[model samples]
Target: MSLFTDRQLTALKRNGFVVLSDVVDDDTIEAARDAFWDGFPTDRDDYEGLTTEPERFENAWEYIEDPDPFREINDQLFPYAEALAGEGTLERPDGRIQVTPRFPTGEQTEGDERPPLHRATGHIDGYGPHFDEHYEVGYYTVMAAVYLDRVDPRGGGFTVWPGSHWYAGDYYADHHLESLVNDATLPAYEDGEWTRGEALAHQTDPLEIHGDAGTVVFWHQNLLHCGGINTSPYTRLSAIQRFVRPDAEEIKRDAYANPWKYWEGMDGVELPSAPSER
Candidate 1:
C-alpha cells in the first residue's frame, strides 16, 4: 500500500516536507523514550545547566551504545521512507540514530525577549564547516525526524523553510558540485549563504513543526532548516535519520540541477520556476 496520498506527494514536492501523524503508537513511543533515557549519560553535570548550554549535550547518539533501541519505531517508518525514495536507493538503517534533544535554553527566562523562532539558525547540512570531511553536497536523498514526545509550538520543534529546495537547486545549477566539498574554498562558504538569502526572499516564512508523539516528518535534502529553541520547561526529544540513494554519486550533477529528479512520485508535478531575479 502507498504510504502517502496523492495530495501528500504534491505537498512534498511543493513544500519540501510532509508530516505523517501518529505513525508510531503511543506505547511504542513511550518504550523508545524510556530506553533512550535509561542509556543516557550519567556523568554529565546538572540537567538545568546543560539546558542552557545545549552544545554540550546536543548529540545523545554519541553517548548511547546501542544503535537501534528504537528499532521497532524505525520498522514502522521503513515503508514510508522506501516509498518516498525508490527501492534500493535508500540506505539501510544501520548506524546509531541521531538523537537530537533540545533542552530548554532559557529562552523563556525573564528579561530575555527574543522570539522562539528567531533563535533558529537555518542551513543545509553535510556541506558546512565542522561537519565530517567525508560528507559532500547532495549527499542525502531525504531526511526523517521521528518525534518521541509531544512538541509544542516553539518548544524545540524542527523548523523548516518551506520550498527552499527549489531555491537551493537554482543556486547549485550554476555552481560546481565540488564547490561544497571544501570549506576553505570560497564557494563552499558562499553557496549556503547565498541559497539561504534567496530562499528567505522568495519563499514563505519558516515553519515550526509541532505535534504529538509518534509524528514523523520527512523532508527533501536541500531544504533549509534548523532546530527550534526550547522555551518551555520540557526537553524536545527526536531522532533524525538521512537516507541516501544508492546511485547518488552517479547522478549527482543531474539531481543537483533538477530538484525533483530522484523523488519517486514527483514526476510531472508542476512547480513554480526558480525566481528569475537571482
Candidate 2:
C-alpha cells in the first residue's frame, strides 16, 4: 500500500511541500531528542553559544559518532521516502543528521525591531557560491525535515516560499539547460547566480511551519526555504534528510526541464506550467 494519500501527493505537487503529522512515534521522538541533547556540549549553558561556531554543532555526527542513535527515525521514514521518490530509486539514509537549533532572542515589546520570519531571503540548496570546492550543479528527488521537538509560532520553524520550485525550474530551464547536464561547462560555485533574486521577486509571502514533536515535512529540491529566527524561550531542534533517485544524473536534463518529472503518481495533478521565458 502507498504510504502517502492522494491529497498529500497533490499538495506536494502543487505547494512544493507537505506535512505529515505524528509520523514518528513518541518513543522514537524521545530517543532522537535525547540523542540530540546528549551530543550538544555539556559545557554550554545555552544554544546561543553553539551558534558562534555553528559548524561544530550543526551535525549530530560531530558529537555522537554512532548512527545507532538516529537509526529508528530514519528507518521509520525510509518507506515513505521511497514511496515518494519511487521504489528501488531511493538511496539509503546516510548516517549524517543535520541539527538546527534556534536559540531565543531576549524579551520583545511592541515596536521592538526584529528580523523577518523568513530571514533576509530564501535560497535553494546545492547551487550557492558559498559551497566552496564541494559545489556542483546538483539536484535531488526529495528533502525531508523531521521535527524532534514541538515548534511554536516564530520559534525558529522551517520557513518556505510556496511555489518557488516552479520559479527555479523555469530559471534553470531558461538559462542553464545544457550546463546542467555538462559538468565541464557547469558554473563554478563562485560564479553561480542562485535563484534567490528570482524567488524574492516571484514569492513575496513565506510560510513558517510549526508542528508537534513527530511532524515530518517533505519538500521538493528546488523549493526556496530558510530557517526562521527563534523568539521563544524554547530551543527548536530538527533533523534533515535528502533522498535521490539512482538515475538522477541520467535524467538530469528532463528533471530540469520539468520539476515534477521524477515524482511518481503525480500524473493527473495540474500545476502551473513553467514560463516559456524568464
Candidate 3:
C-alpha cells in the first residue's frame, strides 16, 4: 500500500502544500524520467519565455503523455492519487492522470550554457506579466509531484512561495488584483487583456523543497512554486499529477498549446466549475 496519509492531506489543505516522504521507488522514477528526456524536441526553438527560472511547463505537456515512456508512471500514480485524494476524487472515465519529466541545468546541445533562474527561489529575477499566467486560489485542489531522481539541495530542488497561498487565492478569486494568476475564460487566449509591465516584487524567499529520489510533493493550486532546477550534474526529472475535485473549474491551458501543433481537447474541459467554491 502507498504511504501517503490523512494527516499529510490535512497539512496540504491547511498550508497549501506538503511533501510525500518515501512514497516512490528509484526504478519507477528513472523509467519515467528517461522516457520524457528522450522525447524533448532537440530542434525546436525553446524561445518564448523558456530561458530563465522554471517549474511547470504549459507547452510541453505532450512529452509526458508519450505512452512508451510514461505508461508505467500513469499506472503507478492512479492508485496513489486515489488514496491521497480520498476515495472518489478521480473520475475514471474522463479524469486526467498526469506527470512531467524535467531536465534542469543541462546542455540542450553541444556547447551553449543554460541561462539563470537556476538559483534558489529568492534569487530569481522577476519577469513581467506576472499575474496573467497563474490562477486564483481554488482552481485546482491537489498537485501530486513525484520526484523521479535524487534532488541535491543546490541543484534547484522544487521551491514554493510560502504563505502566498492566502494572497494568491484571494487575488485569483476576485479577478481585479492580479499578481501571477490573472486568468481568462474557457478558450484562454481568444479573449484576454495583454499583461505588459513589471512583475510583482518579492521580499521573502520561496519555500525550498529538496528531497531524495523517492519523494512525492503534493500542493494546492494556490501555492506559488517553481519547478526544481537541476543544479546537480544529472537531470532533475519529476512527474506531476494535478488532481481537482469533481466539481471544479480549470484554468484553461490554451496558451500553452504547442506552437507547431494544435489539439482540440486543450481548448478547455470542465470538472464542474468549482472555480472559487473551494
Task: Point out where model 1 deviates above 4 Å.
Answer: 42-58, 65-68, 109-116, 128-135, 178-204, 268-278
Model 3 residue 254 distance off true place after TM-score fit, in angstroms: 22
The lDDT values for all models are: 0.69, 0.68, 0.47
Worst 10 residues of 1 by lDDT: 182-191
Ranking by TM-score: 1, 2, 3
Q: lDDT order of candidates, best first?
A: 1, 2, 3
What TM-score quantifies how close candidate 3 is to the native fold? 0.57
Q: After superposition, how far is residue 106 of candidate 2 from its true place, in Å?
A: 4.1
Better of 1 and 2 by TM-score: 1
Best by TM-score: 1
Error of model 3, residue 144, in angstroms: 1.3
Q: What are the models' TM-scores?
A: 0.80, 0.80, 0.57
RMSD of 2: 5.5
Instruction: Compute the lDDT of residue 38 as modeled in candidate 2.
Output: 76
Candidate 2: tens digits of C-alpha lDDT, residues 1-278: 76888888877887799999767788888877777677667433554554444422345556654456477777777788878776777788765667666655553322245456634366666553323455445667888898889987777788887776776676667665433321121222222354321335233578889989988999988777877766665667888877877777688667866888787746677645632233
